[model samples]
Target: MDAFLFQVLAGLATGGIYASLALALVMIYQATHLVNFAQGEMAMFTTYIAWSLINAGMPYWPAFLLTVGFAFVLGVLIERIIIRPVEDAPVLAVVVVFIALLVILNSTAGWIYTYTIKSFPSPFPKEPLFGIRYMSAHEIGAICVTLVVLSLLYAFFRFTPLGLAMRAAAQNAQSSRLVGIRVGWMLALGWGLAAAVGAVAGMMVAPIVYLDPNMMGGILLYAFAAALLGGIDSPMGAVIGGFAVGVLENVLGAFVIGNELKLTVALVLIIGVLLVRPSGIFGKVHVTRV
Candidate 1:
């Protein structure tokens, strides 16, 4: 039972990482109806920025904040310069652009950083909690950060006028334009926000895993599976799905299978979910007007 509890806690910590990235994907999908395949790469680039800052004598907190700000501006700029031009193009175009962006960012990082594995400083203490007997501070901090970010995003989308405009534009671009909303800018903002969120996830996970150009690649797969499991259109679903996937993966890896096949299990679950419920646990069935 203790081992089970420990695995559950461990899963939640890992799931928090997945959930953060999944939330970013959800944000982009909600606004633009297209997944940003470059999300992980963008996050990797921003995390390198944070690493550079820390190496330059900046404290972890300050470096984190600076990286986030840089990530936001970078995201906005990328949207304006690259994505906006192809906004009205076919979905294939957008997908191709994302793939191109991924390659560009990955190559740049490799050239700049030389692909050496580096250790990152943890924002949370490494000590284990007293009395809990098994829970680590790292795990606790991850859970807290995840919940806090999720709450803030929920409030932003629920209460802010800009958020409303973005949602409106996402639902119907033509209708939003008729009402004078800048649909294009809203889409850009969505990408910017998603990028920033992905940056946070990357930074948080970097300390746990070694920092590398491909650090987020595997996590990206887990996140995609979680997002699909939870419902691509539902932010809350993404969070829930991430946790569920995380826990299942951890437990199964510990008991039913080896750690080597954990990702395989996650993929299998994703496929099973798609087959059983195409709309996902929290996804709404879209009714297209013929």
Candidate 2:
């Protein structure tokens, strides 16, 4: 029982990382109707930036904040300069661009960092909690931070005026523009927010895993599974889906099967969900106007 509890706790910590990135995926999908495959690469880049700051003697917290800010601006610029021109193109084009971005960023990072493994300090302490015997303090801290970030995102989308504008743009870009909302700006803002969220995920997971250009690749797969399982278009779905995927994967790996099949489990879940309900749990099916 203790071992089970420990695995559950550990699952939640890892799930938090997946959830953060999944949230970003949901955000972009909601706003622009396209998935940014480069999202993980962007996060990895910003994480490297944070590492550089840390290596230069800056504190972890400050470096993290600075890296997030930098990511936000970088996102905005990419949207304006690279994505805006092709906003009205076919879905394949956008997807291809994201793929291109992924390749470019990954290559750039590898060249810059020499593809070596490095360690990063966790924002939280290393001690375990009072009652938890197997879970570390870092795992607990990850869960707490994930919850806080999720709450903030919920509030931002629910209460803020800009958030409303972004939502409006997502629902109907043409109508939003008719009502004076700059749909382009809203799209850019969405990308910026997604990048920032991805950066947070990268930072949180950095301590648990080695720092490398490909560090987020596996997490990205988990996030993709979580987002798809929960409903790619729904933010809340992503959050719930992330935790579900994490728990399911860990439990299945530990008891039902071996660890080698974890990725397969996630893939199976994603495929099963898509087959059962193409629209996803929380996604609404819409009929296009002819």
Candidate 3:
């Protein structure tokens, strides 16, 4: 049972990372009714920025904060410059643009960083935290950080006026505009928040996955599975889905198919969920009158 306990704890830690990215995905979708296919690449780019800052002698925490801020600005700029032009375009056009962004970011990172896999420093110590044998310090720290982020987001959306405005804009832009809210800017702010969240995920996972342009690719897939499993439209559902997917992935990888086929597990989950219940575990089915 000791071995099982350890794996579960480890899975929760990894799940926190997946949950963070899944939350980002859900955030953008909630605001714009579109999935940002470039989210993972965007995260990879910001993570590289963090790496560069650290390499340039900036302290770890300072670099992290700066990178997150940079990511927020980048997201806002992309929304205003690239996405705004196509806000009312066909879904296909938007998808194409998202793909274009993914390719551009990936290529740019490879060009600048040379596709080299670099080591990322962990803010947590190597020893087990609190003298616990079941989990390492980084794992515990990662989970705490994820929870803190979630709590802050909850408070923001539930309490702050700007957060309420953003929610209203997302729910009904026409109504929001009627009520004197800047719907366009709210959407831009949503993008910025999503990018910031994704930056945290990238940094948290980097120490374990190592730093590379393609690092977030597989992680992104798992996050998709988590978001879909939990319901793309529900933030709380995404968090639950993230933890569930994380545990499922680790357990299955350890006992069933082996780590070699772990990515396949995520693919299977995505396909299975789409086939069986497209609405997802926590998603609501909407009906429109013809």
Candidate 4:
């Protein structure tokens, strides 16, 4: 029972990480109706930035904030410089551009930081708090941070005028533009926010997974499955899906198939969901009018 409880806690921690990244994916999908394949690589790059800042004697919290800011700016720049030109291009062109962006970010990180894996520092103490043995301090801290982020995002979208504008733009760009909303800028801002969220996910998971250029690859896959499972068009659904996938992966790996086939589990889950319910648990099916 103790072992099972520990696995559940650990799975929640991992789920928080996936939830953050899935939120980012859903953000872009909602605004542009496209997935950014480079999202994980972008997160990996920003995490490396945080690592460098920490290595340079900055405190963890400060470095984290700075990296998130940098990621936002980087995301905006990418949208303006690369994505803007292809915004009206065919779907294939947009997909190719995303793939190119992913490759470029991955290679650039490897070239700049090398392919070496580095240990990331956790803000939380190593020892479990309150003498609890089931969950570690880092796991607790990560979950708290994820919840805080979700709350902030909720408030932003629900209360702030800017957030409301962004939401409107995403829902109906043509109508938003007619109503004097700058739809293009809203989309760009959405990209920036998504990048910032992805950065948080990377930093949160880095300690457990270690820091490397390819570290987010498997994570990205899990996040994709989570996004699909939750509903690509729904932010709240994405978060829920992320947690569900995390628990499923951990429990199944510990008791059923062993850890070796964990990635296979994600693959099967994605395929099964697509075949049975392509719109996902919370996703709405789209119907195009002729």
- Cα lDDT of model 2 by residue, 173-221, tens digit: 8899999999889999999999999998898899998799899887888
- Can you write out model 4's per-residue Cα lDDT over 1-290, one digit (the tens) per residue? 88788788899999999999999999999999999999999999999999999999999999999999999999888988899999999999999999999999999999999999999999999899999888889998999999998899889999999999999999999999999999999999999999999999999999999999999989999999999999889999999999999988999999899999999989998999898888889999988899
Query: Predictions ranked by TM-score, top down?
Result: 4, 3, 2, 1
Q: How much lDDT does candidate 1 score?
A: 0.88
TM-score of decoy 1: 0.95
TM-score for each of the candidates: 0.95, 0.96, 0.98, 0.98
lDDT of all predictions? 0.88, 0.88, 0.93, 0.94
- Cα displacement (angstroms), candidate 4, residue 247, comes to 0.5
* Model 4: CA > 4 A from native: none
lDDT of 3 by residue, 84-157 (tens): 99999999999999999999999999999998799999899999877898888988999998999999999999
Candidate 4 lDDT for residue 4? 84
Q: How many collisions per candidate?
A: 0, 0, 0, 0
RMSD of 4: 0.9
The predicted structure with the larger TM-score, 1 or 4, is 4
Would you list the rank order by lDDT, best first?
4, 3, 2, 1
lDDT of 1 at 273: 83
Pairs that collide in candidate 4 are none
Clash tally for model 4: 0
Which 10-residue window in model 4 sums to the lowest lDDT?
A: 1-10
**Residue by residue across 1-290, what tens digits does model 1's lDDT show?**
98999999899898998999999999989887788889899999999999999999999888988898898889889989998889789988888999999999999999999899999888887677665656678778878888888888888888999888989998899999999999888888888888888888998888888899988887888888889899999999999998988898899999899799987987887788889886679999778999
